[model samples]
Target: MTTENVDTLEFNPISAASRNGGYVALGTLGGKCVVLSNLSKNVVKLSPSDMKEMDLKTVCGADWCDDNYTYFHPKQEVMVFDLRRLATDIIRECQVKGVYVESYERKSGVWLMPDGGLAVNSRKLWRPDGTVLEHGIHAERIYSASGDIGFDLDTPAANDDEVQCVLNAFGGINWRNNLGAEMLLGWFGVAIASVAMRRRPHMLLTGAAGVGKSTALEMMKWLSGKLAYASTGPQTMAAFYQALAGTSRAVILDEFEADPSRRHSRDTLEIARMSYSLQEGDEGIVRGTPGGTARSYTFYSPFLAACINPAKFEPADVTRWVVLEAISRKPDAVALKEAEARVIGPRLARRFINRWANFQKNEAIVRKHIIDAGGDGRMADTVGVLLASYWTFVSALPATDSEAAKLVELLDIQDRIALHAITDEQRCLEAMMSKVLPFKFMDGIALVTRNLSIAEAIQRICDDPTGNLEITMRLAQLGMRVGCVQGTWRMFVANSPEHQELRKVFGGTKWASGGWSTVLRRLPGGTEGTQRIGAGFGAAKVTIFNMPADLLPANDGSALLAA
Candidate 1:
């Protein structure tokens, strides 16, 4: 064709062409014919026929010949020539920078390569329009075909070695703030993990001040390589989502405080929830964007653990967490000193890695067991894949049934705490009540008298309680009517004739305040000066009345029952 005519020809290129339908034209350039293809509205020149002929000889490569063509040049690049021009142009151009072209055949769409001759036996090429031309048995194809042919190859063999490795890496023991108690309580965590794998499992750990929750989390970090710690509250859900999308493992959230000053916005939480279920590239702006953005964001690594102090959060936050109540007993000085002196962190990490490797070897069995225990079956594979690297740490440690039991217990406690924090007002009230009355009295009250529900009572206590008297008033409003009778304010059953029964159960006279004083009176030498009073005394004599029997149990049976 003449140059003017060639220039006049439209180069409107479709995204891709099919092998059976698309066309490419060759025009004379100098004395040689130059291959060209339409790219949307523009025409781009390809290699000259003479150059293609010369390069075909020197460019040693492997070519796969089938319905579709794939060419791989040794020490060069790879290219796929499909019958469809759209697919051919896009795939070729996109991968061209990374591959070297060698010999190609136009008619058969065959390519020759230096690496593996006739590699096309199991390859597939896709056109720009998303049509696939199967050349060889692809991994996905094999999986599909096997199912179609009733091969029944879906059963996964257990990797006992891998499971053992992971168990070892974790030191067979899972540590937490309340090591003894949490060991018994951590089963809820297992359940949660199982659930998360199926749906989206996210956990938040919170506990009282001075608890070693942070320390425990740090230990987990050493075990799980896919952990990331967050130190501040300004981090947006979007940022965290993006971070998680890149990793295939779990994340470790550390020092997360539910401080009102640092609380995440509602939008942030929504995004976070969305992120848990979103795969990479499946995430996009569902709203807010003008035309809506299609995000192909990558998947974030799952969070392995999260740790926070209970004091840092409000009661409203309990629902979102699996709390591990820290041990009230302070760590012994000698234990603290030893921990401080030794470089246990790195050792722990190494142990975890070794255990993970062992676990990976037995993954199938372990996963099956986990699934049987209510874990997500789909994530059975991931459990092994993700934990395989940290198994050594657990294997060498002293792991016992007791420890496992303890872990399950702790997990249960956390679940309870989370549920109470989220939905149950009585639990919140119990927590608040503990601060005012003895912890033992948390569930002792027959009725709570307060203007508001348990939630309101707790909130009021948290917000403004001038003194014990105000607390008494708030409690009275709920139901456990506390009033000044005989000049002493005391809790009493509202309009109940079972005053004697209440006294016997709670250990105090009808008018006496049944609390610390009554408890103290039962102690040795505590009730020496205490005086007993007859029933029906007015509010005046109630203060002087001391009925230790009201506080004392009738027998060990009653005490045990009360306990």
Candidate 2:
């Protein structure tokens, strides 16, 4: 059935063998029989009808083959079972004799090329000494969207001046302070060393339009070279997972506003939350596929976002981001040049890659220093990697002892600010207090209408010994009660109308739930207490937050009301 009909058959096994260079095998993937061969780079999944046609070229040249092989075949129908058996026998023979040559597969990130050079992406490879090569090398086998943007670095020497472009571009953002600018610089370090680090932190560059958000994104593209997937708008979680699959390329999403109310935005936030730390044996974000099977997506890359309107996230999600707010360009600020970013981005990336071994060494030291300076585990990780990365970049630069001390002092200040930063609970408390509600006085019955501030009404009632029962009753209907407890004034919060209203602004946060007692207790100067503000309500249990000095009884209880 084989050689006897080889002359008349549409597909000849002998001819197919010769065309394939005698390199092919049968392998199973996802419980489906597939043909693996050196003629293609991926597994070839053929249909039963195609097998009936005995299409040797289509079957062998499927994505499974690494190279193209010519095989001519007629359209005549063939016995599918016999052909399958013959193909199986050929694969078995090839396997036994070791005829197939498998291509070496490499992960998509900074990797060493076969020629002892470093491959940063599809279009660029650097020599051992951080110099760009004349021709590109196929250093990676994984498919990536970032591979389309080729790296065009030609820096003969990747020196401090070459990397200074990063500092200069970041400087253009008009950061609120030196810490924010320095943190952005450190983020560049995180992007370069993303593949090597176990925990890659994320960044959010948020501000008003014309505040250099897009420019910052462009700078990220330049610094990342071929190791970044830069998007101009918001994207779904699936898009991010697909783009970052099997690669450590930094994800830069410009104009990425994550509204927690929307399902898609929530999913995006969830992705960022989960990507912060990669614990050992951590099974990545598991999602249901079209076939009802679970697919795991592991993102090793750092996520960066730029937006005008920042989205509110849960405490867990907020801690994962090193939020850097951008400001209007100062009148005296230096303008960043695109030409410099284009050239210097690749140079900075090369420096980071070439000095990776040393960066790791310095990062450990910096992490220890951060932890010693009152930073928690997460803070240490986020700020430590950044400082460590910056130090790694400028360590080669000649500096005085004072200059080195300045860097240490900067790290100490950043650590202190991070440690004392406004927490999510505190933000929620402030938001709730700032929320304005109306209270109109009518005899003893307070109408919940207008011309009153919530803080003012609370202060007025607490200061008046005559007992403003109307305002107290109004407060009760809104799920809250405010009065003076001893010398300190406190506001009692419960599950009511105010709770639901606050939930709208603070959704996806701890304050969104009915468990206000536990959350409010975390606020500064807060405790559990009972307040009986109205009749028939016998000392209702409530979470109490003490009014701060500013809100405490002013000289006539009119301080808050004046504004």
Task: Give per-model TM-scores.
Answer: 0.34, 0.64
Candidate 1 per-residue lDDT over residues 141-208, each given as its tens digit:
11011001100112122244533332332232233433332221122122212212323334455555
Predicted candidate 2 versus true structure: per-residue lDDT over 373-475, tens digit per residue: 5566767677667766777677764333454446557754564555447576676676666666667654456444565666677666656635566777777
- Which model scores highest in lDDT? 2
* Clashes in predicted model 2: 11
Task: Give the whole-model CA lDDT for all candidates, comma-separated.
Answer: 0.32, 0.59
Find the candidate with the highest TM-score and give its number: 2
lDDT, model 1, position 57: 19
* Residue 128 of model 2, lDDT score: 39
The number of residue pairs in model 1 that clash at the backbone is: 135
* Candidate 1, run of 10 with poorest lDDT: 142-151
